[model samples]
Target: MSARLYVGLMSGTSMDGIDCALARCDERGTTLLATYEHPIPPATKQRIVEISRPGDNEIERMGALDRELGHLFAKATLSLLSKEQVPSTEICAIGSHGQTIRHHPPSSHQPSEQGFTLQIGDPNTIAQSTGITTVADFRRRDIAVGGEGAPLAPAFHAAAFAKAGHTRAIVNIGGIANVSLLHSEGQVLGFDTGPGNTLLDHWINRQLGQAYDKDGQWSAAGSIRPDLLARLLEHDYLSQSGPRSTGKEVFNLAWLDECLADLSSPATPQEVQSTLAEFSAESIARGIAQCEVPVSEVYVCGGGARNSDLMRRLAAKLGTATLETTASLGIEPEWVEAAAFAWLAWRSMAQLAGNIPAVTGAQEEVILGGIYPGARPRTQ
Candidate 1:
């Protein structure tokens, strides 16, 4: 089959915005054609964060937010197509990762509960509104099959960013961080590391009302409270092996408060921010250190890559491995996650499998997502 165009939409754990990427894919490979981003309104963002944790009147609020996000996602898709002057009929499908609100993957803490994940922007709404096919709710099937149903992007990373004779690790630092280790011989390994920008963003937002630390300048100004950092790192999830995943459920503000309560002396906001930054960096580096295959280079993607303080801490912890943004590998850091979704969409349209069992610990590889057919086919 000849190459076909596809759009991928992702609203990650950050809850900051929707990222849409247009790309071409076929048997050869996928190519990112153009990209666009739509920021989430503050009200919408607040609603997302609020419901991400337990709260009352959740069903009513959640139902409303789900539809609201679906509309936002469709708007993002249409805006991208408009910017590129591409007709709706020209795109084969849209792979939407949606917004993750609750991710209770099976673990020691929640072993009794069945694993489940909820990513809300309704694909039906997206398809109906955009007049384009949409594939979403990509994680649940994997969960059903006893997989973490996450770190799915590693499969795409192995396909798109792997090197021939060296082991490379791709670290995606969104609200949560995950690492993909691509071996020289083509074996792919991946798992969620720990906190990425979720804590830092939450800390900064709660402390200063800023969306983020702005390259981690505020964090850079503060001293890393050894006590706080040590307490934060002691979380059991950080020590778990691969085939694992995590989210705000375990590392949100409530969790942070519990740790802070343990600190004998109160910490300044900057100090706490610094410690959170260090926590992210340390957790990431620890994950890398556990790689069975030594990694020669580390490429970081997602919002955390832009945090200078986090980057410096990672570099120091890494010691010898070359640390660079995914841009070094021809894909900009900011767009990697977005592009991965695009690739997943392409895989789905091709009736190909999108998840790597090795990474997510699924019993077998599975073609992910539920497809909502588009209203129009590409114009002949």
Candidate 2:
């Protein structure tokens, strides 16, 4: 049988860039063919952050961003193909997760109502620009079936990391942190642990004008002020159970300011950043302990994994040896999310159910993603 190829594109909460991955997948499994990261233009990034929580002009700006991002995503794919020498026609489809603006999980008052989630990207434009069939909007169906419609990485994590006898937790420390706990008994549990680098990133950027902590060097140079850490953890979301989700809506710069106000001594901005990193490590460790299943090891991924201070804090708090990344297990950390969309697209094409009912709380298994055919001829 010939190899089947698909391109996967992901723009995570970090608002860092567009990650594109080409994969060869078959009945056996999937393998990464080529991967590239296309940074979001500074202006575009600022626009996205502004519209994340929009006003009356939201509709107009959202439409514009969708088209803009679609073209950027297509460009990323084309660039990858050129660098890898792969013909576009060789790929079966392009799976784009788009950009998530909002995620509202089902609540007690609205038990009967399905949760709502939104991702904006013009799939039609992506197809037209790349000449490859595109599959996008992979979250609504799970939400419609009563799921939280997020932390969707667990299904893919299970496929990539689930072991027969060992229990493990895959922690993705993006702008937000989420964990997928896979057990020997075949039980998989996942949810947003809380703020990861989001709060720290915003605080540092505001205080130091740096986009990120840069291996958490500044954070390492400072101390974790206990009082500030206590205040930051007071939010109710920290105590929330699994199947819960959160984003910038609940944990943004404003939230940080409120927490900061409760502090008596004004520590240096670097110290505050250190405290925030500790907050992330503590929250993640606490969340993992709450899981019913035992986790023998923690595999860290996403941009956060590269931060030495963050990883050191995480290992110390969790009392587990930190593993390198999914790459060590044959899948690169950067490509994990992108590869997931590729898997989702393949499942959609096969008409197979993708979402895990237990993880998402969906009423039942459902096939995720909507397909957009390219203008070119379809291959049999």
Which segments of model 2 are wrong by more than 4 Å?
1-3, 108-114, 320-322, 377-380
Encode model 2's per-residue lDDT on 303-362: one tens digit a residue: 898889998888887765455667677886767888888887888877888888777778
User: Candidate 2's error at 221, in angstroms?
Assistant: 1.0
Candidate 1: tens digits of C-alpha lDDT, residues 174-261:
9999999988898889999999999999899898999899999999999999999999989988877878999888888989999999
Candidate 1 displacement at residue 54 in angstroms: 1.7
Against the unseen true structure, what C-alpha lDDT does each candidate score? Answer: 0.89, 0.84
Query: If scored against the real structure, what TM-score would every candidate get?
Result: 0.96, 0.95
